[model samples]
Target: MHLSDHDLRQFDDAYLQTLTSAQARALLGKALADLKAARERLGQNPSNSSRPPSTRLPWEGVGGQETPAGEPEVPAVSGDVAAVADTPGAAAEPEETADPRPRRQGSRRPLSGAPPGRRPGTPGHSRTQHLPVDAEQSHRPTCCAGCGQALTDAHASRAHNARYEIELIQPGVGATGLLLHQTKHTYYECACDCGHWTQAQPGRAQAEVEWTVALTEWHLAGPLLVAFICALSQRMRLSRARVREFLSDWLGLELSTATINQCLHEAGRAVAPVVEAELYAAVRNVELRYADETSWKEHGRLRWLWVFTCATATLFVVGKRSVEVVRQVLGETFNGWLMSDGFWAYRDLDQRLRCLAHLIRKAQALEDGLEPAAQRFGIEILTVIATVMAAVYDARGAPPPAGALRARHAPMLNALLNECLRQRDAPHEKTRALARELLNDWDTFWVVLDHPELPLTNNEAERALRHWVIARRIGMGTRTAQGTRAFAHLASVIETCRKRAVSPWPYLAEVVRQRRQGLQAPPLPSPAS
Candidate 1:
C-alpha cells in the first residue's frame, strides 16, 4: 500500500479516529505484513539474495550454515531443545550444527582407524636429477674453539664436509633461456697449536620466522631461487603446481611443488619485517591514506584482506574484517586524513573522508528500486553530490576560503537533509536505509566541499588490492595462517615497490639473500621525484 508523506506521518490517534473499526484493523494488518517483509529483507545474504559477498556475516557459512538450493532450511536444534520443541507450543532453541550434506567426494569421515596425511602406498616424489657444480668455495675455520689461538688454511685438516647449493642466474646479455647455477661449499676443520679442531658451519638467522621452513644459509636452493619462486607465486600469480611445471619445461629444473611453496613462504617471511618497520610506518606518517578490504580465504575458512595505501607506500593485511584490524593498521592515534568507504569501523576516526562514489552507487541502486518516492529522492541526492563535486573541481586551481563551498551549497544541502529526515521511516526499506545513512554521517559527505584537496573516492586502496584479488581468484587464497601472513607482506612490498617506480624482483632477491645470511634486508628505494 503506497501512502503519502502526510499519511505516513499522521498515523496518530487523531488520524485513526477518522477511520472505521474495520478500516483501522486492515491498516494494522498491512503494517505488520510490511514489518515482516522488512525484517526478511534484512536477513538476506550473499547465498540467498542479490547482496554482495562483503555483506555476508562471519557465522553465515560456518556451523548450521545455509543449506543448498531446493532444500528447506532446518534450524539447528540440540537434543535437549529438540525434545522440548516436540511438546505443544514449546519453542526450540536454535544451536550450531554440522552441515549434514557432504561438500565434496570423501568429505565425510574416512573409514575408522585410517591414518592422516598421504594414504598408504601413494606414489612419492623427490629430487632425482643431480645438478653439476659450476663453482667451488671453501669455508675454513679462522680460529681454534678450544682457545683464542688463531689458525689459517695452512693448518686445515684434509677431511672436509661439502654441500651443494642450486640458484637461478639471470640470463646474460643476449641470452634467451632460463639458466641454473650450482655452487659447492666445502667446510674444512682447522688444527690449532693446542690440538683443538674447529670447523665453520652455515649461518642461521638470529631472527626467527614462523613458517614450515627456517631461513638459513644451509638451504639447497639459494636466495635468487627463493626470490624467483616468490615472483612466480606472488607477482606472476602462478600456483605452486604451475610454477613447478614452468620451471621443469623452461629451465629443466625438476623442483617439487613443496620446494617452490617453501621458497615463496620463506621470501614472504623475510620481507615481513620490512613492511612492518618501513612501509607501514610510512603509511602512518603520510598526510592522506586510503583503506579498503575484500574477502579472502585461509585454509578454506573465510577471512578478510585489508589494504592501506598512500602515494609513497602500500601495506596489506589479512585477518578479520573488524574495527580492531583497522586500528591495527592505522592505529588509534593516526591523525592523517583517511579516505575510505562507509564501513562502521572507520566511523570513529577524527579525520576521515567518506567515499562519495560508494554513496552515489547506493543512490543509483535506490533510483532503480521499485519505490517512486525513493527514485525521486535518489535523483535529488545525486544532483546535490554532483553539484558539490563540481564546486570542488572549479576551485582546484585556486581553492576558496574554508567553508566557502559548504556555505554556497547550504540551501541545497539543507533541503536534501530535510527530505531525508522526513523519509527516515518511509514505507520503502531502501529509502529508509539511505535516509538513516545520510543522517548518521552527514558531516563526512560535505567535508570535501571545504577542503578541495581531499579525494572523493577510495580508488587508490582499491587499485592496490586489484592484483591480489585476481591472484586470490586464481589460487583460491592461502592455506594457512603463515601462508596468509606471507601473502600479505609480500603483496605489500611488491605494491609499494611499484608505487616507488622500482623493480621489486631484484630487491626481493637481495632481501632474501641478506635475511638468509642473518643480516638486515636493504631498504626499499625512495619514490621517484
Candidate 2:
C-alpha cells in the first residue's frame, strides 16, 4: 500500500477524470481517507491526548491531564491555603524586611497588606527556661598589636562583651536530669606593652545571598533546636503555627511563631550552599535518572517543583518547568538513559526510555471508548506490550543480549509497528494520537527491549514527589523566594538521606552548627554499609 512521491503526484483531478469505474472507486477511497485525517487533526483537544488544556477551544468541555489506566482520576482538592512563609500565619506574598516600627493591635491595625516577616515590631516571646549558666569561658588577645610580644591573663584589661548560648545536652553527657545547658562566652580587651588595646569578639556568619530571615549566632535557639524546627516544618510538613504549638505543648518551650519561622529559614539557608554545590554534583554522575514535575505555588502564583532521582541520591528544584531546567540539571550532553513520561522537554534527549505505563493508559482509554476499530487496535497493542514486558520480567537475573531479544520479539514488534502505521489516521482522535505517538518515538518505546537494565516506568521519580504533592495541597505553596529555596534544598537533603538509608536530622543539625561558625557545612552523609 506504500506510494512513492511520483505515484502520489498522479492523484490530481486531471488524472482522476480519465479513470474507469473500478479505478475511480479506488481514487475516491483515498480522497475520503485524506478528508478524515484532516478533520481528526482539527479535533485535537487536551482530554484526548497530551495537548495542553490552553489549546482547547471555548466550545470544548473542561478536563485535566488524562489519568493513567487502572488508577482512579484524582480531582484537584481545594482547601484553605496554609501559609508557609517567613511570616507565621500570613498569606503568601513577596518577602519583605521586618519593620522596626511598633504596630498597634486589633482595631488600630490596617486591614490588609502587612509586609512579610514579623509584623512591625510586635512584642515577641522570650525564653521560658531560667536555668543557671553551667559553664563560662573568656576570650582575650594573647599577643601585642604594635610590638611582637607575648601577653598573659594579667594583660587583660576588662570584660567588654558577653553572650549566652543555650545548647541541648547530649544524651549520655550527665546524670543532672537537665535537658539543656547554657554557656557564657565573655570577650575581654587586653592592653599590650605598646599601649595597644586588642578586643576579642564573638564570631558571626551571614548568608552569601541575603534572605528575609538573617542567619547569625545572636539568636536564642541553638543549632539543634533549629534543626528540630526544620524536621517539624520541612520533613514533617508542619505549618509555622503548628510547629510553635508542638514546641510549647510538648517541650514546655514558649517559642513565638516568628522565632520558629526564622529557625526554619536559617536551617534552609545554612544547608543550601552544600546542597546546591555538593548534592547536585552527585546527581550529575548517575547512570539512570528519573524526573517528574508537579504544580507549585510561590507567592500565590503558579510555579513548578521538579524532582530528579536515582538509586542513591535525589534532588528537588522549585522553578519553571521548562527545557532549560532539564538542561540545567542533566547538562547539555547527558549520556545516561532518562526515564520519564512524554513531556516535550524530555523529547530532545538522545537516550530516553518512554514510560510504557503511560502509553498503555492511553491505549486503555481507546479500548474503553465506543469505536470498534479503536478498541481492537487498543487490545492488540496492549497484548503485544504485555507479552514483551512479561518476557523482560522472566529474564530477571539473566537478560538475553539485544540480538537474541530482537530475534525472539521481532515478529511481534514489526506487527505492532505495522498496525500503528495503518491506524495513524484513526477515526477516533485518541486512537490517531496514540498511534502517532508510538510511531514518532518508536525507538524510545522499545528501548527497554535493547537495554534490559533500564526501568520500564518513571515511578521512582513520581514516588519522590508524592509526599510533597500532599504538602503542596495542604500548605498551598511557599510564600517567598526564601521559602522556595528552603523547601527545595531541605527536601533534597531529606529525600537523599532516606534513599541512602541514613538519618538526615543529626547531619542537618551539624550543618547548621558549622555554617553559623563561618565554616563550610560537611558533605551529605553516605549510606551506612
lDDT, candidates in the order shown: 0.82, 0.79
Candidate 1 ranges with C-alpha deviation above 4 Å = 1-125, 173-177, 207-209
**lDDT tens digits, residue span 91-136, model 1:** 7546747775444454654344555677778987657899788999
User: Which 10 successive residues of model 1 have the least lDDT summed?
Assistant: 43-52
lDDT of 2 by residue, 57-170 (tens): 443457433455776654333233322333475664668667655556644444455655666668865566576888998888777767857778877489988888766654
- The TM-score measured for candidate 1 stands at 0.79
Q: For model 2, how big is the CA root-mean-square deviation?
A: 11.7
Worst 10 residues of 2 by lDDT: 76-85
Q: TM-scores of all models?
A: 0.79, 0.74
Q: Model 2: which residue pairs collide?
A: none
